[model samples]
Target: MNPGLLLPSALFSLLALLLPLLIHLARRQQQQPLDFAALRWLGSKPKPRSRFRLDDIPLLLVRLLLLALLALWLAKPVLHGAPDRRTYVAVMPGVAATTVAMQALPANARKHWLAVGFPSLDSDPPADAQPIASLLRQLDAELPSEAPLVVLATTQFDGADARLPILSRSVDWRIVAGAPPSTPMVTALAAPRLQIRSDSAHRTQAGYLHAASRAWQTPAEFTASSAAFPNNQQIVLVWFVSDPLPTTLLEWVAHGGTVILDSSHALPQSRHPVSLWQNAAGIDLLQAIAYGKGRLLRFTRPLQPAQMAELLNAEFPQHLHDALQAPGVAPIPADARTYRPQTGANAYPQAPYSLQPWLALVLALVFLSERWLATGRRGEQA
Candidate 1:
């Protein structure tokens, strides 16, 4: 490795070396003339030549060297070279540690789990679903360009992006024969049950919501109640009342129960209210605000055909259902052998190592030497 300076401009501080030279010259001893009786009577002869001589050469040299090193320290010296490269072995959660240990790995290779935090292989395996391709790209960007990577994964991998990752180096992907993660039985999603609470004045409008719920094909579980509040069984509630909502209704919304408020009702103040439903003309038909884990939705206008044309549209039921339910996450499962990373991605530059601490240590030693040479008994006797 070659030594270099980060701030070469700081070398200008070397001009301080002149201080010791000036001090030595100014402290040189002067010879005093004595008045001799016989010589004083004679006329002054030719004047002798004066020679310039420095005092305490050893002490002066130490001070000058100390100042020169101080200047080098201010320049921020560093060592320049490529970072050390080593083999990295990352085992996915489904793969057993014993299986990985049995493989003939490099003697200096590091072992870690391919999870969110990249924990050690000796610790417990991660239980939560991990974004495999995302974590792979992260590891690729972090490792040195010359470092080799070995990924041991099961045949069934999840949480992959749309395309395979392109890394700086070609990765060695190994598929271990082990039992894949257990999958739950796949079933169709259950239809959302609806509960409606309305005053007598808005009872006619409540029928519209009831028709929408029937369109969900879950009418068997649907209930229209004039009760003050709906129970936990009902996942969605239509507030057809004209009056402002009570605190209890807000509490229900905050507890993960979706509520649809009357069109005339004003939505509560929120930091960020999202538009959940929009018409073909790009007009927002419904606005929603998050309340804890749940959402509070409100129609922009009254449910009459003249005020809101969407209420009479053919797709109104589907639109209302989509607004009430959150979108489902798509599953990502693929064969590990086919998902090997490509090698065309851009490379990241490694940072140079700093030598400031070493320079500071040397500077401290030089300072102590200078102090000793300037103030010790030998220096005083000289």
Candidate 2:
């Protein structure tokens, strides 16, 4: 097979082949000279002696080998060898490994199964979660280009809709035309209890908390006492804290209890979704925040019932209901099966293989040998 060079320019290191010759000449043995008159008469009859000759033949061979190794290492040669073994199989999600082996695979090839759904060898794929397109891209980067991909999958109707990955190389697909496994709607065992510090002026925010808590089938209470302690791991909602943030509130947040902050207090930065209501003039309206386990909401201007009459709208309460819902509830499964390749869809593309690693390995061995020999020679000289 033809080989590829990563850094052909480094072949200039071959010029170092002359280094051994130069060193041998520089270290030539010295000849003894006789008395001037007698020596001159003898030289008149004798032909001139060469300045350099082969000395320490073994050492010369070793030095030549060292130079060649360095040149080859720098050139970085890689063989365009035969195709890699394409035995690794990616089993898609929404289909359990045990079930897939039963339906699609034979007894022999089933032994080398890797999860395509989650790309993990150990963990089971989530039932309701959607498949990610980036997983295959990651796989492509890890595996060698010559290594072919073999995909084993079914029509993933239960997961979220995602585009099928297009690989750089031709991938063999052994498709099982079947639906996804059934999904279970998971929920919390009991609704959480909520306590609110209410203000008559900020009734809008307080009302939302009360309504949202009830919508989630949880009990919500309004308390006037600032010193009241929550019972049974219950949550507290603060409309506005004019004084320092309640230490109790922070403790509740740290301990997994939610403390919904009011709009009157500046809230921490968060990535929660928010909904806004504006007047007919399209002026600035109130914004809401869902930070960590809690939520914060505030209006741009002073609170007015006339401007935010939509707070009492029926759909608005449902939004609050969704916002207040528990975080880990299982969602409905969505379908992500888009590409079922025909024979024509397959591809075979050339990819580069690097030789630097192998070259480096050999270079290290030669370098160590040279160092060992040089040290021994020094010891002998002493």
Candidate that would win on TM-score? 1
Per-residue alpha-carbon lDDT of model 1 for 83-195, expressed as tens digits? 66889999877887779978889999989989878998889887744667768878987889888899998887654543567888888888896554532222222567777
lDDT of 1 at 82: 67
Residue-by-residue lDDT tens digits, candidate 2, 1-382: 6798878899899999999878877766455655676566564556476654333565667778888888987887877766555445666654566665565443334223232433353565544322333444545555666565666666553322122445665667666554555444322224555677755666655666577567767758878747665644445454444454654454333223445554456543322334444445875354444322223344454333564665666665555444445343222332334454323323445456777788788777877777776677668769
Clashing residue pairs in candidate 1 are none
Candidate 1 positional error at 69, Å: 2.4
Per-candidate TM-scores read 0.49, 0.47
Off by over 4 Å in 1: 7-13, 29-62, 81-85, 102-104, 115-134, 157-163, 177-338, 368-382
Cα RMSD, each candidate: 15.8, 14.4
TM-score of 1: 0.49
